[model samples]
Target: MNKSIETMWKQGFISEGELVVPKVNDLYNRKSQNLVDKLQHMFAVNIKAIVIGALLLLVVMSLIGAPWLGIYICILLAPLVLMARQELDKSYNLSKGQSSLEYLESFNAWLHDSITRYAIYYKFFYPLFYVGMVSQGLASDAGTRVMARLLKTYPTDYVFLDIPGYVWALITVLLLVVIKYSAALYRLDLNMIYGRQFKKLEELIKDMRALKPE
Candidate 1:
């Protein structure tokens, strides 16, 4: 390992979940700055495309004053939402009793759930945890476009808007789906290994506690 990555690993800088501090020398950090710098490029290529596409459809509807598309947009994203939910459920199921995070003794002792010790945290984080530093601006324009498509009531004119917003919106949604899907699978694999380890620890402790006084 390079000295920087070595130091980061030694310091336990790589971690998961809501605690999403970026580690030094990580791919998102100094070690691969060039790669991380393309995060916006990825978003522009992926998310922005689809969001814009969806908005364009709405715009097309507006130019003709069509009413069908209002309800269509409502249902248009249903499949994506369903797929996202399926991805999340799969991760939660696969991550049962795995360790994705841990705090010191006192920090955890206060938690009431036995599974919260280390294992269940895997499930908690398996859905939305950032693996490395986030690809900042990866989906920045998605939210704005989604809201605009949903709430805006402006007149639609195709001539001024040469660019394809509907395509951008569709690409954005697909990118989010793919990213979440991959992370879910990665989390599932990690939790499966750690889940077994936790089970073994439980068995070992039970055996030791049952031993007769010597």
Candidate 2:
């Protein structure tokens, strides 16, 4: 039994003369274990999803004659898989013998640090992903035809990096827009996936803290 939970029991959460409350203690233990278990499960699932998604993207891109772009996407996603694995390992290796409160605190700290690091990675990732997709599309046969049509109708006298100035400007603006909002986008994504679990963890920690001695 965790010391914090033991303390909680001693502090009147259970009967006055009783040393233990099977029902209450079990409830807290179950909740704590459940939260940690869910987090680990989610991490495992996320890694699998990324791998499957990457493989599917590679296959689809190959069929569409953009194998390089597919490979590039996989390369971009590789770090994410590695990061997730690191997080999963960390979660598994949380300090032994910690009180429930201390354990939760440790997990919370890990979560915060992981999110901060991912925020930085996403700043570059979102923009790069956008650029890769756009560039790949433009290099495709249909995009080539469209570009030819545009160049024919509009003068190509001014060019940048072999692209018509106007087209290049549009791409640049879009890329900048994606980069500007990448952090927010990452937050939104993170929340969508883990918001419920995060909330539960925080609430559990708060409840545990309230039970501590003054």
Candidate 3:
């Protein structure tokens, strides 16, 4: 429905006497707009889900007497909210004067940049989040009681900072592995969440590109 796309459609009809080219162009234009709209809707839903999920977790954590853990997780998640807002603003501000193909391409580029940016954050965030959860759990009252029992059962030589040295070693190894694969893990998560939309977007872009006039 973009004015530029409308103009392109008119031009295509004028240049080519056959209706096939124009009709195909029109079909792709509609598909492109629909796909973009769907993507925007999905993005908004994802943001809402994050906020709702965070609030629910906060409530659960408070009820469980680990409100600080919930607060820490929310703090960690704050940047994600800002990032999504920035990306959503960018999506809204994408130039409307361009043709459908250009618009879709711009969105596709934005998607890639968004994913890369998130991936970079994930590399650090995943590890920090794990560490936060573990550290917070070990600092809680329940953790103190558990640690006390462990101390009574195990030799002090095998304990470090009230936790078994082996547990610390395992945590360290897990953190290292998470940091190394965090981006890949994020991609997998994203794929699981939006795999169908992603595939459709790719196919739409491919079709639009093929239909583009030389």
Ranking by lDDT: 2, 3, 1
Candidate 3: tens digits of C-alpha lDDT, residues 73-129: 888888998899888778877776656666677888999999999999888789889
Off by over 4 Å in 2: 1-23
Which candidate, 1 or 3, has the higher TM-score?
Answer: 3
Each candidate's lDDT (Cα)? 0.37, 0.80, 0.78
Worst 10 residues of 2 by lDDT: 12-21
- TM-scores of all models? 0.22, 0.85, 0.86
Candidate 1 wrongly placed segments (more than 4 Å)? 1-33, 78-214
User: Which pairs of residues collide in candidate 2?
Assistant: none
Residue 183, candidate 1: Cα error in Å is 20
lDDT, candidate 2, 1-214, per-residue tens: 2353345434534332221445655566568777877787887989999999999999999998999999999999999889888877877677746556677798899989989888999999999999899988888888888887888889778865456889988999999999999999999999999999999999988876766556
Estimate, for each residue in 16-110, the C-alpha lDDT of model 1 and write its tens digit. Answer: 32233443213222322222123223323433444556577667756755435433553444444444344333322332122112211111222
Winner by lDDT: 2
Shift of residue 95 alpha carbon in model 1, Å: 14
RMSD of each: 19.2, 4.9, 3.6
> lDDT (0-100) at residue 162 of candidate 2?
50
